[model samples]
Target: MIARSQRERLLEAAVRVVAEKGYGAATVADLTREAGISRTTFYAMFDDKEACFLAAYDNVAEALMRRVAKAYEGEERWPDRARAGLAALLGALAEEPAIARLALVDVGAAGPAAQRRYRAALQRLTPLFEEGRDFAPGGRSLPANTSRMAIGAVAGLIADELAEGRAEYLPGLLSDLLFATLVPYIGPAAATREVGGNE
Candidate 1:
């Protein structure tokens, strides 16, 4: 097989295998079999199963970030941008339950390395939510961890939905997730109004 194709298939298989079996149970053999690649090729691409899973996790996280960032681009206001970004995120997760599971749920079981990677992946979205600080009324005075807290809230909400086997219903959570994201940056009254304003 072509090198690039095998690599892509391996990464895709990592997502599928890990999502189906969970990180602890998924083995290198399973990844290779799922990818239709040999052990040698798999080793050539990655050091081991964890390495492969990490690569796959990063791949999905980066793509999801790109989608949310793209959605936020044209909206004029922070609330609108937040709505657009959260909608994009929820819609994407809903479209791929395996990805939803793998990204938010499976990685936690993968081990310390994977957990660190997951945390780092969540951190990458900081800039997206950080923009809300400048948009808020007491922008500069909000808690130092405003962006991180909002990110955690958003991630936690999505993780709960995914853990409950409600991936397909994720898109419908747009309002709730938006409120969680905006409430800290804005406030309850304005956040509630913004949540209802667009619907």
Candidate 2:
């Protein structure tokens, strides 16, 4: 059986190759050569280029989630945790530009498998915001409908910012946008204070 480490190496190589050459132009042969593995080993690990792309997408998602989790640690308030998590996510995008492109942009090009993976990632992440609903001040809560809208808004904003080459400024911009949106529930005075304190 192939080692997990070897699989990771191949996935990493695939990410780099795909980011450079794009999905249509990237080949399993290119990935295997980049990973310094035999074609047989590549096939043993992944069924095809599409399968490999899915694995690479999973890898990027896991890495981004871990960064977010780390950033959320030690924050007792929900708003603070949300801001920190979003900031960490944006930071990851800045640090790993390929992952931002893969997770947000190129994902659509990867077909159904990638779409499922993206949805799953968003589902897993939703709980973090849900957990912080009480932190909106005065025991205010986020309605389920609004929460979904907020999540979609934030994701779309980040994706657009990354595509526009403003990824580095996304954390602050996202935080302000979310804070403003939540101000009605949390109270504009309190929300402004929180944003000012955080900034």
Candidate 3:
């Protein structure tokens, strides 16, 4: 338990250090000092700065996933639940600007670990798209793979907007953009019904 706590503390410190200094400038000493742990403890916990960074990335992803899971709870319709989840996530990102930057931008520069983390998160998120099974109004069903791609695209757009400091308008824009883009693929009848339901 103590070991886990120390690892978490180190990951938190690593996030702060990376957010403040960028991945290129962040150092193990900086994270150790920020975590209030000795260098020996830091080294014992992580193989190196890169290893620490990967852990930090996982921590951020886990935090974001928790927010998503909470946002999705008790929502019946897939589309409605998706939009709410997106809004909650964007709101969380807006509130935690540093963490947002770290997750969306700094991690990208950290190497393969960043890409792996992104893929893992996307994989975890794919199941949410299955909720589209509720769209029986149009007699057209969305393929799970396509839904996953759509979700990934929407997430990518949100990350781009957040990185550019345009997150304030992202919720509405994402809703409209995703609706427009995905409705076509889902077919006219399904699209019409879904859009009508939103109004």
Q: Which candidate is the best by TM-score?
A: 1
Q: Per-residue lDDT tens digits of candidate 1, residues 61-161?
A: 89988999999886988889888988998888888998788888867788889989899998888888998989998888998899899999989989998
User: What's the count of clashing pairs in each model shown?
Assistant: 0, 0, 0
lDDT of each: 0.89, 0.75, 0.73
Query: How many angstroms is residue 64 displaced in model 2 relative to the true structure, after the best TM-score fit?
Result: 0.9
lDDT of 2 by residue, 1-199 (tens): 4588889899999889988788888888899999999999888877899999888878878888888888877577777777778778777787877667768877777788788898777666766666646655444445665555556767787778778877667655755655644564566787787777866
How much is the lDDT of residue 1 in candidate 1? 55
Model 3 spans > 4 angstroms off? 134-144, 177-199
Error at 30, model 2, angstroms: 1.2
What are the C-alpha RMSDs, in order, of all predicted structures? Answer: 1.4, 2.6, 2.9
| Window of ten residues with lowest summed lDDT in model 2 | 132-141
Candidate 3 on 47-139: residue-level lDDT in tens? 899988988888888888888778877487666776666667777777777878677755678888687786787567666665555554442
Model 3 accuracy (lDDT, Cα): 0.73
